[model samples]
Target: MGRTGGKGLSLARRLYTSRILGLVLGLLCVSVAMYPLDPPAWVWAVMLFNGLVWPHLAYQWARRAKVPYHAEHRNLLIDAFLGGFWVAAMHFNPLPSATTISMMAMNNVAIGGARFLLAGAAAQLLGVGVGLVVFAPALVPMTTPAQLYACLPLLMLYPLALGWICFRQAYTLGLHKRELLALSRTDSLTGLLNHGAWKDQLEVEFERCKRQQTGAAIALIDIDHFKAINDTYGHVAGDIVLRQLSKMLKQNLRMADVAGRYGGDEFCVILPDLPLFNAVQAMEALRERFSFLVYEQNPALKVSLSIGLAALDPAQGDATRWLDDADQALYEAKAGGRNRVICCSDDKPRREVFDSV
Candidate 1:
């Protein structure tokens, strides 16, 4: 598969420091075991280069690769191979050998989970086989005092570095998830909660009213003659009008009010812990202020709103019935006149009109 942008590069950068630290420390662990063996001049030189120089070369290799993520994985396998080679070079001294291989296992699991761990193990075995051929492999079960102390830095500090890296990765993922959730709930056009989110809030409000015996109101608003506006003055102009209404809703409503785009040219608001008469006054004020907003696209292009309101009735069964009442009142308002607020009632007329001045 083709590598996506920067994924491999990011992995390489994250591992670079840990790689340098581990290799240098591993050199110490291996050197103590190799000392008694009286290894030749070339073997000591190779050890120094592998410990002090190889990390920089590996970083450059990954950075320059066309697919940095894939390149980094190859680098990890190479490290595993070298780790096993050193264990054999040390003649498999018990403490140093276990320490070296276990650290390599931790890194493989941290980078790519179990699958990569197994792959690293295979690479290590191959390295051990090559070492046996090249160096006449021998096993030394005892760990002297010097070898034990040399292994301590790699054993103690490498895991701490690896652990910190893992924690940072998890934290970054958490932040991305939160951003995605916000985008999912919000309407792109008006920057308000979308229809479904608002409706969810409505259901919560409904249950609250029923449980606490508190008052709340629902308002369903429609832009009057919206299609005519779009036809006469382009969809862009119509969109400007919609945005203007949404801006007014956000600015005028109280913090407790839940407003959302009910879907194209229509909007909804839930006023919690508010009385019926107050909600009507609030809607009327909004209608009047919105009527006076002059559009920059066409100064002559005037806009108006028709809103329908329904207050909480303890007798109401669910959120749907409450919304239906407001929808019916909105229909009544449009039938009565273009610009007005209609309040749904249980009385004889079943609708009360509040005309715009």
Candidate 2:
């Protein structure tokens, strides 16, 4: 079935189980409270129906309704009403009366919050009024020891069960929230960090390096002749190449390294605590590995990467300046020749050291 239908079914099942447990305990407590008064046979029959048959009837009614949620809510109100009726039948014995009313109130609040809780309380009062007319209106004002002891099980175990259910719901919602956040930050195509998320990480890494006075490097990588590949071999084959490059990066880089797709045919990397030479070596390895990839769609198609490396420099003012340094090096790598790595040196005129493949 659909998600809403499934949720309705689950809620119905939960209500059914809780009703069985609650009614059984409630019947026991009420029976103990009314034993001394010698309740009639019809009263016993009604107790049997409420405690034994009503849970099943409520389940069937809710499951068959157009909206099980609404049906179950009505059933909960009925439970509160019946609890008040029983309280009146027992002449409002202190322990049994309080247990029945409090349990029903807790159920109403748990299911539908404060508004429904108030509504259920109103329903209970209506039942009490009806009982006062049918039965005696007097209050017992005292509970025997047996009635108090009988209420102990419902008071203790019911709350624990309700608390567990609420905790499970909270934990499931937390898991769903975390999954959504991960999807939001990840690229759908490459399964890597998207442009915005990667930029955020770059800023964090920049601040970290500045605070710790440690070395780190950032690289900008572009697929050489990517548009030509797309035109000649089709975009599908170009996508395969991009995915292969991302896979290679994941496999070759250290676990601490952060990588992302900057945009079409371009990627970015943050190598924290790594020197420029080491970053260049790592990028060169990735480039060589990606070059060896053979596409099944077009065996004749070949691709290469041009990467630019820049180390964290004290002279740089902020993360943007560091990114600008890497972009300048990338421009130099493309200008000198494609399929090469260019490292930017910290100097007035910014010298580039080119590493050829």
Candidate 3:
């Protein structure tokens, strides 16, 4: 409710500013039209109140209302009615009358589209009828050169201001849309790509590798004995370990590498243009680095990684088959003892053991 109120207040303030600009210029146009006839003192008083004072009054009315949106909308209708009254009061002087009506119509359309435009038009017609009853029913068809020049400022400047406001709104909405899309694709915990988003990228990488006939490798990394870590040191420490690994992946991989949290204590990486041997060496170095990390919660705690690597095979039918190969290699790594890298080739799986210092 507070947020809604703030939005309403903001809208009311914008409407207030727009009214000030429109009415100030409008007053000049109307004053020029009525000068030759020497209208009554009351007519001048009304014009002064509408041009100089009404914008502030309308703003206060909307700001104080229980629902400012509805109040501001009602204020717009009043603006339309006043515009009609002025047109009739000017005795339908061609330049001022058309300018007044067209500006009100533009305001109505901008605020509430076609429906409000029609509603405002009806209100203006009613004001014209009231004017005919109160003042003389007359229309002056000719517009003097002075009147044409008087209408110029509102005609040129008001539309420009309105267009700028609309463009700003469009640009803001586009930024919000892009932010939402990025959030949707990112993992909440790791700030990396989520599982589904990573799979989508995997398919794209697979297609690229097949088309270009380039060497690329994918690795599935699992934290050995992660469930035991969570059980021994609590989930918070386990979360710390996961975050540290994600940080390492971000720091070690190239900009082109696609890394993601593949559920539980497992992560996935797609290394473009890298051979199986180099990919294994990279994973082994990452594993050794992660093992040396010291946690604040547990000084003696130790962790190790089991990594499975697979190079893109020309004989592979689809991305799913390629993923299955990586998964098979991961199973072999787990089976061949927990802290090692296993590479799956077209013929057989090979294990690489390294010092666990």
Candidate 4:
């Protein structure tokens, strides 16, 4: 159920209505369960007045300020104030009404018991405070010390239970947030880091390389003549090629390596704590895998990759330089011939000649 907040009606209205129904039903249960313990008529009158006043004020406030209330915010100010009213009203009657406070706390737990625990605890505490204020005179008039001491436990217990429940809910919410963050950083198609996520990861990897006094390797990969494949066959065939290439890279890479799609047919691999020799070996494995993969559309037609690799110098202090060098090496590979790996080193010309057919 929903309602409008200066827009079309939202499901918030239905949800709000349902919460109200639950609250009313809970009160009815408490009333019935505490049978023969009815409070004075004056106490009922005060509760009736409060039932009208608090909701009316809340509705007017929601209307004027355009607050959206639903299950999520069901225990917001209005609900808290109403729950407080229950405590104070019960003071006048002092019927067996502990259930009201318990019900308010339970309502929050039903929605997301962990995420909104603090708010629920706060609400419960507010109810406790109201009960104290309402029962102050009653406490003074009690003839026996046992009677006063008996009520003391409930005063402390309500908020304590609420606090524990809220803490559990909050811890669960934190775990869920972490899971969501990981999913957001992952690429759905290639099972690699997305471009934006890769940049952040590269920065961390670069820092780690600098601190550990280790060299890192960056490889830029381009599927050779990918556009021709898409043009010749349909997009489905093109998608199959991309998926196959991604699978080849994943299968060939080591556990420490990270791969990401740099956009279009280009992909980047970050090899942390790797020297030039090992990086070359990894690229060789990828090339070998590519050579063996049979295209589903045409097994006779071969597919290949052009790769550029560069080893980073810790003294350079620029991760971007390594990527530029690798990109330049890739450009050379594509120019000389595809299906080859080229290296970029200061001592070398940053190029490797590939034999083109």
Candidate 5:
């Protein structure tokens, strides 16, 4: 019931505005046909209630029900029944009767597709039966000019309104799908690409550099003693430190550079179309800039980065190997000291370590 209600409640709400428009237009169409036949005072009163009051009442009924979706379905069948009843009461006038039945069918199909259409048809048949018992079966074959004009507003306008509603729903669902996809790829804390998304882009960068025989580089950055920061300061303070690093990455990196939170206490960057020398310089500048950031919460709280860089190696077959190379350089940076940039080169046997004083 809970699951059913979750789906059903929205159905009722979505239908509410459509119901108001459809029923009001249908009333105008049905009323014209019934006018010629001279319905009794009670019939006229019933028509008014169905046209004006029933839409609101049906909405409330479905909305308040435990299984709102089921309640709304019931409300739609009732709508079909009323449409049939009106057709019979009007002596089955051609234009108005067809308009009323088609409008109801359109509404039913939009709600539940073919199955609901069949169910609505059955309800309409039952309504016709009851209406026949009350008013006696009679056929009015010809449609007057006035009746045709009355039905025109319903025939033309209601479909446009319903179509627009469906369009709006489709557009909104598409927007939500795009947003969800972005959230899935992003790290919630750092707002950088998540581990998986970053790796995927690394693969693309590796292929691009290898195929073109162009130089690029990948960097692994570790927040020095990050766990100690959480242990010394609160986790909240540790989180702020992490966010600070991400902000600096965005500010320092070029648009072509891809950055991501590789894992706990570690970030990664891919510098496309950049030589090994320039990549090292960029990492060094970033390292220096980050070392100076001061937190307002803890003015004395200071932090630094350990960076390891690996240039694109055509000899390296896969992205993981490239990542592993950077990881090894990062290990060396941490081993050397807490605040410096270390460049790992495929061309050289000895790695270059830049220790900032």
Candidate 6:
């Protein structure tokens, strides 16, 4: 799997493991508590120790790891382990007092807090349901109706705490995803769309133009004598030249224009709702501006670009054809002598060319 896919899978595995662990701990706690001092105290103590320490170990590992942390899983696992340990600790005491029951109720409080804080409404309901399942043996069989009535406050408390906790966790996760996506799609050096992101945007724009019957123009641009500049001034100067040219292109284009570095010394622009003639004119102006711009310590140095322009055809409905046409035009511009804009129509074959290879 790719890095992103692996990261996503790891996140899912952690969440699934946490949930299963919670279910197991809940079952273990309730089953152990049901015995009512039938077993040795050391057995219960051992169980408690394992329950508490194991989840803490996992939680700490997740916190330290480079992988993205899912707060819901962390909180749930911690609460589940703690709740199990609390019940086991009570089992070790063998005291059938109100204090024992209160301690069990407090276990529910901790579970509720983790659930509500990290998982929201669904977690609140889940905490209440699971708590009821764990504590049912003690609460449901009470001889007095008043004793059952007194449990209401704790019951309501679980859901409310769970809801609050989960809501905050959800918001934080959302913000993190948004920031990660932006960074992934952006070019770190040029502050433009990266090649992958630019391709995605182009496909979407192509579909939109096809559906809306809107004209779209694409220009393939290359910096003239880029290697000579790099060889003469050093890589740092080359990078500065690229950055300045990117800035100039961005500033010169319309607000709706989308530009990206296709590869080293090559750039592409997607102009939506633009005609072929206007795109040619725009490329001409850009070439003129670039020719006049001075490079560092090279006063006599002249810079020029060769541009190929292609306009989308609604009848054809093929984005690839537009790019192919632009590529042919770019070849023609280079052949006819560098530093000029060439359209697809300008590269048509002569009458006698049909006989030649």
lDDT of each: 0.89, 0.88, 0.87, 0.65, 0.91, 0.60
Which candidate comes out best when scored by lDDT?
Answer: 5
Order candidates by TM-score, high to low.
2, 5, 1, 3, 4, 6
lDDT of 3: 0.87
- Which stretches in model 6 have alpha-carbon errors above 4 Å? 1-161, 295-302, 315-317, 345-357
Is 4 or 6 the stronger prediction by lDDT? 4
Where model 4 places Cα greater than 4 Å from the true spot, the runs are 1-68, 71-161, 164-172, 297-301, 346-357
Model 3 segments more than 4 A misplaced? 1-7, 346-357
Q: Give the per-residue lDDT of model 5 (tens digit) for 1-357.
A: 323355588778788998899989988998888888888899989999999999999988887787888899999999999888888888889899999999999999998999999999999999999999999789999999999999999999999989988998889989999999899999999999999999999999999889999999999999998999999998999999999999999998999999999999999999999999999999999998888999999888889999999998888989899999999999999998769889888798689989997
**Tens-place lDDT digits, model 1, residues 1-357:** 443356578788889989998888888989988999899999999899999999999988888888888889999999999888888888899999999999999999999999999999999998888788879868888999999999999999999888988888888889999988878888988988899999999999999888998888999999999999999999999988888888999999999999999998899999999988899999999999999998876999988899999988877899999999999888888888869999986333457789876
* lDDT agreement of model 5 with the native: 0.91
- Pairs that collide in candidate 3 are none
**Candidate 1 weakest lDDT stretch, 10 residues:** 1-10
As for lDDT, the candidate ahead, 4 or 5, is: 5
| Model 3 per-residue lDDT tens digits across residues 1-357 | 223353478678778878899999999898888887678999999999999999999998888887898888899899888889988888999889999999999999998999999999998998887777878888788888998889999898888887777777688889999989888888888888989999999999999999999889899999999999999999999999999999999999989999999998999999989887788789889989888899888998999998888889899999888888888888888887878777786444454444354
lDDT of 2 at 200: 97
Residue pairs whose backbone atoms clash in candidate 4? 1-11, 1-14, 2-10, 2-11, 2-12, 2-13, 2-14, 3-10, 3-13, 114-169
lDDT tens string, model 2, 1-357? 223352377688877888888898888888898888898899999999999999999998888777888889899999989988888888988889999999999999999999999999999998898878879788898888888899999999888888888787789889999999889899888999999999999999999999999889899999999999999888998889889888888989999899999999999999999877788789888877777888888889878889988889988999999999889889888887888888885543566565654
Backbone clash pairs in model 1 (N, Cα, C under 3 Å; residues 3+ apart or in different chains), count: 1
Clashes of 6: 10
What TM-score, to 2 decimals, does candidate 5 have? 0.91
Listed in order, each prediction's TM-score against the native is 0.90, 0.91, 0.89, 0.65, 0.91, 0.58
